[model samples]
Target: MTNFDQLHRFIFNQANVRGEIARLDDSLQHIVHSYEYPVQIQQLLSEMAAATCLLAAILKFKGEIGLQIQGQGALKYAVVNATDDHTLRGVARWDEDLPSLPESFAELMEKGVLVITITPEDGERYQGMVALDKPTLAECIEGYFAQSEQLATKVILRTDLSEPERAKAAGVLLQVMPTKASNTDVAQDTGFEHLCKLTETLSSEELFSLPVEDILYRLYHQEEVEMFEPATIQFACTCSRTRSAEALRNVDKAELLQIVEEEGAVKMNCQYCHTEYRFDSIDVEAIHAGRFEDTATKTQ
Candidate 1:
């Protein structure tokens, strides 16, 4: 019955295929409003976030998975991260002084590369790269699956960021299931393409407004779909004063003290959540003096 801010998994009983749908409302707003980005920029980040949510559902790991795209064009980069618990956050940067903005994702990049990083809790980190030659983020992701997993995958990402305060994003992931049936009949089956066509007809309006069950019915009313328990998606930033101090620890203490003396405080802002942290001379000295516990960390 969940309408938004949730992800659902469904499988067709008659076909060897599975799909996932993610509806993001409040989660999208939390990220879209973190900075005063234009509608296009907001839309880009929304797609990345939705894609992250969908990918996280299918991938299993103990830690987190991150998707980042960098290009030699107007959009410098955009990245989104999703944890195993369904928490996600993202941010993007682009040229603000353009006379006119490009409407398509590919137009923003001259030579783009999308990187997917997997960091398991107890294992080595892994990274996979895909060329961003596709017209949209969804297609590029589909290409990634095609190249890396060698699976027939179709990804549909839709977003409405015209109203940044009430932005909504949704995505659908459809892929052929691996089974003895697939081992038996790879050429005779056309169910995967048929399901993808039904999924393709899902408009942004229907995705953003309808409940999961209703949307599933609209797409697969004739097919037998088995729904699994859904999971809630949320916006979470792992940025705090401690992490800020740890980030600052890399800088020279004397330089930090000079900045504090000039501005009366050293200020640091978390780009993910727009939270500001200030440190005075005492805080700076204490930080350098090892007053806070140190742990292996990275800036968010």
Candidate 2:
């Protein structure tokens, strides 16, 4: 059986094109089950999470990448983050009391924008945003690549949210990077488009169930392709009491202490994983005193 939660990278040597196939299982489960998300939102989050993983794995970066959508529609906000190692986490908030939510990306996020943020380990952080002009996230991503880097790219995101308990998400990314070699642009562009057609023939079931190598061969049996080692993708929330405490550093100490006195503890909940961090009077004191990290890590 194919191992779940792995991303396979492949290159078409003759075409000078690269592609990725990712299958997500455990990662989807971890995110969807973290909160009580509506079916529509859950599906959107699943697709965004998978796309984020695919995006992160392809980039040559050392830090994190985030894919986010913001608007005032039924789904107010949704975001997913992925690190260099393909670790991912995501969250979504919407109008829960609505009788029904829009299914299409454009309607779900009226006046929304698709944002991509890249934070490198050593360099400056970069963010790019585009209006939610397309009906799907895949199209918007393709547009992003075209607008930002002027690269020819194709993206496909699929999810099965019919049964929340068995939620599944998977995707593929194909891009034609600039070739320094002389007289190869025509051949590369032709090959890249041909490969994209074959890639579009891939069904959701085949992507979810087939082995990585088999999937590639099924699509590009006639092409000269090289497959690399697969990277594991997982759901990992980068939240903790210490990090949460750090968030409260700039807030009013008097107000925080007042909450501690009235509500018994200052509370902060991670929207991604729903992990709660509570601070009583002593914890509040330590946090403001700049001595909370040591104690918080120990207790956690």
Candidate 3:
């Protein structure tokens, strides 16, 4: 069987249209492992994961791309992040039991806005946000591209629940870039429209099942397409005890001691990975004494 957790890129040989597809099997499964999420949230995270992976693969940065949504309704927040290398992690929060399956995006995330953040390795981070007026996550991202970058971009995503504790997500992105190459009045417009029409034939099952070439051929048999090297995508978390310690160090010594005295230990839990880190009395005292080294990369 073909590996599903990979990102593939393709280009229309005779047109300015280019595209990317990402399939997430392993990464989605991993993100849902620790907690038992409802069907609707599970599917929601799967879609967010797929979209984040595809966006991460295309951005020209070395750090990470984060897709975050905040709501004033049932679901308080949802977030997914993927690095340039396709390492992804995500989580969500809600107050009570949500519907097993939401009928639409509005049902799950009411009055929500999508926040996109790009954090480069060695520069200031940039963030862009858009209101969620679209019906699907793909459409929301497409809206971002149109408003933020002014590119003609379309995103199509699919998620399937074929087995217990397993999920498959796939998506394709098509974008047209302005070029200086001359073309007949009708040629370039016709070519771009044709490519988009071909891309519309992609089925959800085919997106999750067939290999890349078969899917490409099924969509665009008349046009010559160039496929690029694939990038492997997987689930990864950046949480660590050192990072937690740094956060703890930001608190006042007196306040920290009071918490330690009352609770006997300072407990820090990573919201992303759900990993817990505890600092007992002695550990807190050490930090107060300024005896700890850098707490950022200790786990590394």
Spell out the clash pairs found in candidate 3: none
Task: Determine the backbone clash count of candidate 3.
Answer: 0
Residue 156 local lDDT, model 1 = 94
Candidate 1: list runs displaced more than 4 Å.
Answer: 162-164, 178-190, 293-300
- How would you order the candidates by TM-score, starting with the best? 2, 3, 1
Q: What lDDT score is found at residue 138 in candidate 1?
A: 95
Pairs of residues at least 3 apart in sequence or in different chains that clash in candidate 1: none
For residues 92-119, write the lDDT of model 1, one tens digit per residue: 8888888766888888876999999888
**TM-scores for every candidate against the unseen true structure:** 0.88, 0.93, 0.89
Candidate 2: segments with Cα more than 4 A from true spot: 180-190, 297-300
For residues 1-300, what per-residue lDDT tens digits would candidate 3 score against the true structure?
Answer: 385899998888887778899988877887765577776677778888988887886677689999998987777888999998889999988657544445578877889899999999989999999998888888899889878866677788888876767877888888776555433333357476667677888888788778898998898888888999999998888887766777777888788888889998788887777777778766777776777654433221
Q: Local distance difference test, per candidate?
A: 0.84, 0.84, 0.80
Give model 3's TM-score versus the native structure.
Answer: 0.89
